[model samples]
Target: MKNVGVDGSTTLKVYESRGGYVAARKALAMDTNAVVEEVKKANLRGRGGAGFPAGVKWGFLPKDRTTTLLCVNADESEPPTFCNRVLMEHDPHQLIEGTIIAAYATRSQVAYIYMRGEFHEQFHVLQKAIDEAYEAGYLGKKVLGTDYALECYIHRGAGAYVCGEETGLIESLEGKRGQPRIKPPFPAIEGLFRRPTVVNNVETLSCLPHIMERGADWFTGIGPPHSAGPKLFCVSGPVNKPGCYEAAMDITVRELIERDDMGGGMLSGRKVKAVFPGGLSMGVLTVDELDMKMDFEDPRNYSLLGLGTAAAVVVDDATDIRLVLRNVARFYGTESCGQCTQCREGTSWMQRIAQRIESGAGRMEDLDLLLETARNMGMMPGLSICGLSDGATYPIETIVKKFRPELEAAIRSQPAGQVEAVLQAAN
Candidate 1:
């Protein structure tokens, strides 16, 4: 069993011993355009909630454009998702090699690793690795004695979830408030100082080295068709063994939970209540659908759940759905940059309603009002700066739709003892 968090251990020597930099060497030997074509063939999608195809994004850079940039989104602020942290700390060079290959494919001259400010330890680890690469001649001008010239730098973000967004990150990097920019001139066309840029998540880039090292067919064949390659599943909450697990895409929630190799079921033999296959943004799945596989298409087709970043968060029978929704609502509300009227006001309104309901101060009609407000907030595309507006509204809509009985029960019972119990258990 090879350790998955190999990059986190600051064992760059060990990483090289495990065939780490082979992909960069191979990529340098091939034509840049061919590398992009190979990535396209692999069908590698973005792991940063968007699920956009990575190669297609790389191909979007204008051929005539100069001064292209590749920005790695390592700001994993999505609650309960820790896959990127493991990759950065365990296998820094894997990301470095992947970033170089991506830059080569896009003909970018420079790259930046925009990381979360709280990841101080991992940031230092990556910074050390970048220095090692530059010293070893893997980075900087004319790398590996080839005509290609590139450099990689690390930029720390000031702990804003909105900065996880591509355009918001660009603004934050420029020392401004983190607010997402409207698309039309998408990041691919104009990004990072108004030049052509391609923003990819850490996991999306980490897999690139292997994709180029082994071939697009080999990379695509690792996981299920369409949803190709190994995914790092971040399992947390009430599970016996809560941590990250790298496995094929076809593994179901039942297998992941019950199997000893993964989280090994709920702690203390508790009943599974609900599962968020992707993160807070994705719709929740009831216990009845526990057998649903954690793949791109399976959840989409069977459970109506979006596969954003392939992040799996499990909630047990002891957990209260209303309580969880309240916390989730507060996160969105607090993080809303207040750029758009709907998101600015809607997030605050949703949080207040959820809190009232959770605290037993809410009226029966408040449910309908919350749902209507959420629907109204979601009316426009690219509404509040980034998807913060959409992200906040999604869980509210999903919780109301999927757990109406629970909401109704909470409202009807209104017992002080039970409310206190739910509140205590939630914390």
Candidate 2:
């Protein structure tokens, strides 16, 4: 619940002075099962898009498992989602401590922070924090004079968006291309050098310290049932304030954008055309749906995919919807690892269609084709390798679905006499 790095609290000495590693000490003293149970009671969901229960994820590891690895997913490459980056740069020790607690709960001795390579400053900040932790006996050989031991290391990713996926991250950590692996043996049972591994988001791990300190009941009581604990939201686009803000999961999208403490409303007094309520993958929401709650159950009410990373990228009335769609298409298209032909091919096609549509070269049937293509890419009928395709599918599908009228209007309004001008501009 506390923001550590906002006021120059990055140093180990500062972190320790504010009772940073106390939870690790507490976790080390308790039985690992007890720690896991406490986290389960807190109802802390993963902050990394999926929102899976972190405690449940920890429970997936087999009892008495040897050579387990805990990987902290610091690959904050998702567009407009900079909450993790802010946390890492400002309070590196918090993540380090959280990593230690997670490793202890999972009974793992070796932990890796899979950070994005572009986070050059945050990478060094975390590395120095790890070094400080090691020097202070908070990490390495024996954590805080306890028998529990953990060696935390920083594994820099090559800025591949696929590496944000756990298996892909594990593969890249092993010096392979950042493509996802087929699941049957989920990462908890088989991962990271073919041994048991547990991957958790940086924010997910960061929540442990608070959960351990405040107790599960306290943490769970903070938000609505399932959506318990404080959530960090990254709000970008044409807002008066574009930054990471924290609030309970029950907060509505309108409040997040309109509240003075949050986004402080849209800039230039423009009406919102659509908002990617929880980053791009969650799909776009109309201005009328701004009152929708951001909780897991509430998003479905507004026809959203789900709460993905809880990062909102607002698009105001002045911005073109096609441009937004094209941008989303381009990101997924460029990031697809090509492991599955469905995602690899579908994303490219979506990009082409979206670009063509945006450039006034689209036909009336293009919308249906785009929707059909997105649907096919979303679910592979066992052909798709990972969620990348699905991730790519939702935004395009939802944007097209929700803003059909706008797109249609744009197409109809295209000047027939300016075909050459349009073509030249597109080129």
Tens digits of per-residue lDDT, candidate 2, 286-373, equal 8888998988778877767789888999999998998999999999989999988889999999998888888777666889999999
TM-score winner among the candidates?
2
Q: What is candidate 1's lDDT per residue for 324-425, written digit by digit as tens?
A: 878888988998888889988888988987887877755678789888998888647755556777777777887787788888887887865655565467
Instruction: Tell me the spans in candidate 2 whose CA falls farther than 4 Å from its real position.
Output: 417-427
User: CA lDDT of 24 in candidate 2?
Assistant: 85
Query: Number of the top candidate by lDDT?
Result: 2
- Report how far residue 13 has shifted in candidate 1, in Å: 2.2
TM-score each candidate. 0.93, 0.96
TM-score of 1: 0.93
Tell me the lDDT of model 2 at 297. Answer: 74
lDDT for model 2, please. 0.88
RMSD of each: 3.7, 2.0
